[model samples]
Target: MELLRNARDAGARNIYVASVLRRRRYRTLTVLDDGQGVDERYATLIFEPGVTTRHLNPTIEAVDPNSPPHGAGLSLYHIRNLAVRSSLLSAASPTSITVTFDTRVLPERSLQSTTRPSRSNLRATVENFARTSRTSAFYYAQPAKILASLIKNHIIHNDESAVELVELAEALGLRISTRTAQKIKNGEIPAIERIDGSGDGGRRRVMTERGGEVDGSTALLDLGDEQMSRIAVILREAAHASYVEVHDLRQSSRPGEITLTARVREPEDEYE
Candidate 1:
């Protein structure tokens, strides 16, 4: 998001972001944007777990026009849990929409075993066009598409020092002020959560509804902006770096039991 250039775009002209700290001393992040808003029909489903614009685009005619579930019910439900009270501000024009994520409760574990290997959608799109066409393909394309998403969303870079993210942002052509950089970094949730050694003698955090801790693949770290920037750098480093990603040291523990697993799979196979 070349801020100076993109600020004039109709889709994201009115975007604003902030962190709301609650009485319980928890954090709820809010993003108000003038992008194409979520339709009222999809409002209830936007935060439902696993719901995505990609899936919703294909099934508009299959379901009733007037219905409870617009699409995937789980992602929004998962969003509800992560952010506590979640909703689309959709305040003014249909294009102006907002999403709020609460940092009080825990994140979903259904996809805890899941790993999101990042890719450059912009490049992928162009590459798809190049396929079966010509050797002189989408060339010189670098980090522009992802850069726009990062800039437009005004990402929350996790727990890193302000100077760190700023330098990277400059590399990606982000013209954000230092004040905005601090704001983005401040929204990061802690990466290394303390295990409860007291209960059963440990202060353990559990994601399972049964109160049994699922120690493997928990969010040991949040992908703050700087972290995401680091990821972009890694992806750009390798032309073969399709779906490349970056992460910090993440560990999960419990007083009595803990689990850890790391594996890789092909593009079609899901990661666990």
Candidate 2:
């Protein structure tokens, strides 16, 4: 949350959070933002206690009394100390901060057991952040697949053209190009499948239809069920549709094709 708050404070419009596993034993978390680049001189200093470039805004303070004041810079200090290693690289635009941890390290047991961090925990954190954040945020897993995206609510709820919907789908790593999304919108291509409900929050799955073409014909989303369901809600609202359908293309007899569909329904037919 500190990393995200810092990005927002820096006037960033988009923020990306990514988690990567290396050598099967180490994990790295990266938060990158295309905000005003940090000066090379202060890149390392910003992590020090009581060192900060943020200025408190009266408007923001009025909205959230708990907003940090200027020079209250212990957030990064604590973050760095908790991680095995952390670094800030801001020589150019899109400042990037990375924190790495040794996943093999066992917790020191005390009177009570403690749960180690997992992907689900990360998802929950991001979801909570999305609910309140005003800027666009994206979460990605290793190999550059976007697992989830949080778009501004106004665009999702008010946009009439559905342009933002296509952007949201693309940000979620749906593998749909602008042209393809346009085709889907025009009915030239089949409707895209969407999750029916808040899915069973379980392990990530990469379901692909057998022999599916490697081109744009297939979209392999590696996301938990809850994230998928949240995305479906956004897509449905953006498209002004009642509900979107989720087709299990893996069960189809066709050798190499998959498709998604969405349809309009009566207001009374809406699902809870």
Candidate 3:
């Protein structure tokens, strides 16, 4: 129920829910949507209680009449606690999400998976995704190099200092605490490190523990359609390229390697 709500809130116009029988004992349930899927970065964070991307007073109602209309983020968290095995998959461009559940595994592995989800790690992931997806507008060949150049050319000068990043965040009207800024500068937050540019040229620098490397897994970014559009405009104008697109490089040699590619946006390209 909560998963459905999340998809609806993410501006999904079409949603599909499926269930399959596994060996007549285990049941597999799946929900697929064309909405603003969970960001590759926020996949696990969404399983944490009290974490929500929806507005404070979202118009969407709860799937259950007894549940609160707010705090849709808690839905999946609670469900994960009760369910057996679950996964969240999302992609950019089309902003598709697929959530699956394998209830058969819960009874046996519940004890082994009792550790609470990491809030700090989730916060860092979200912060990075927000900053980068909101800022970077284009992807190009040699994305990492181009991004580094863009930051040096426009966002930052040369020195990569914590204080400078904090100041930069403030200048851009983003709320970053001293501790958070320091963590980002030090690369403690492996998802995103810094965001640069203002107006139409906003860009973000993402850092990851595993750089440019993916083992056939999807990493979602927690960005909205409006945010991507603005960034595309900025990158398009700045790169002087006819095309601009954003993609998650799960298989990169560098950690947090977001590529800027040249693919002109069309009506069907809208993520929402």
Candidate 4:
């Protein structure tokens, strides 16, 4: 959270956060931002306690009298101490910070313990931060998971141009060529019902297994047989989906088309 706040304070317009597992042993968290970056000379010094370049803005302080008078500068210091390994890279513009935790060195408490954070946990963290963030924030996982996050968060809607979608995908480390992005935008490759209310062609509605209806907000993704379990994990974790239903729309009209839908848990629903 402090890392995100630091980026925001640096005047970042776009921030990307990624949680990755390396060799099934190290859990890594990377935060990248397109903001005024730190100078190479001060990169190491910025992580020291009481070291900061920020000053309390008078406008913000006037708005909130309870605001701190100065930056404490302990955020990066604390973050560095908590992680097994951490590094910072900066240039004139974009800056990146990575923190890795070694699973082997961490204490085990449960039989179901895992080395890395679950998809749901990562999604929830990003969603909570995005609720009040002034800048755009993206969370990266697998390619399919990233696409799902983009659509679910309204970062990439059906109306978005193929170029825009491709650019966003590239930022998340998913290299989508212009042709594939165009196909996705046109509902051609990995074809699914269009979400935009264009005409009768886009009139289809998604239904959950419990008979609930999903409106135009439903996210669509194309997946193969082997990718079903991966997508299921994302739906279950990120959306707290009760159940997922798959419909094989493959026919003469749309060859190899498959649609996946899930029931997102409402706020009123009891937690399991």
lDDT of 2 by residue, 165-186 (tens): 4654434323345564454445
- For all predicted structures, in order, the TM-scores are 0.26, 0.48, 0.33, 0.50
Report the number of clashing residue pairs per model. Answer: 24, 6, 24, 0
lDDT of 2 at 180: 49
Better of 2 and 4 by TM-score: 4
> Candidate 3, 177: how far from true, in Å?
50
As for lDDT, the candidate ahead, 1 or 4, is: 4
User: Per-residue lDDT for 86-110 in model 1, tens only?
Assistant: 5554432322222333333443122
TM-score of 4: 0.50
Candidate 1: RMSD to truth: 20.3
Global lDDT for candidate 3?
0.43
Best by lDDT: 4
TM-score leaderboard ranking? 4, 2, 3, 1
Q: Taking the tens digit of each residue's C-alpha lDDT, what string does model 3 give over 1-272?
A: 45545555666543333334345444444444455666666666877887776664365342345655666567777777766555564443223233334545542222121222221222222223333233222221111222232243343343557666666443322335667666554544433222222332222334444452332111234334676677766765754454444333122232223443444443345556
Best by TM-score: 4
Cα deviation at 31, candidate 4, in Å, is 0.9
Assess the local accuracy of residue 80 in candidate 4 as a C-alpha lDDT between 0 and 100.
76
TM-score of 3: 0.33
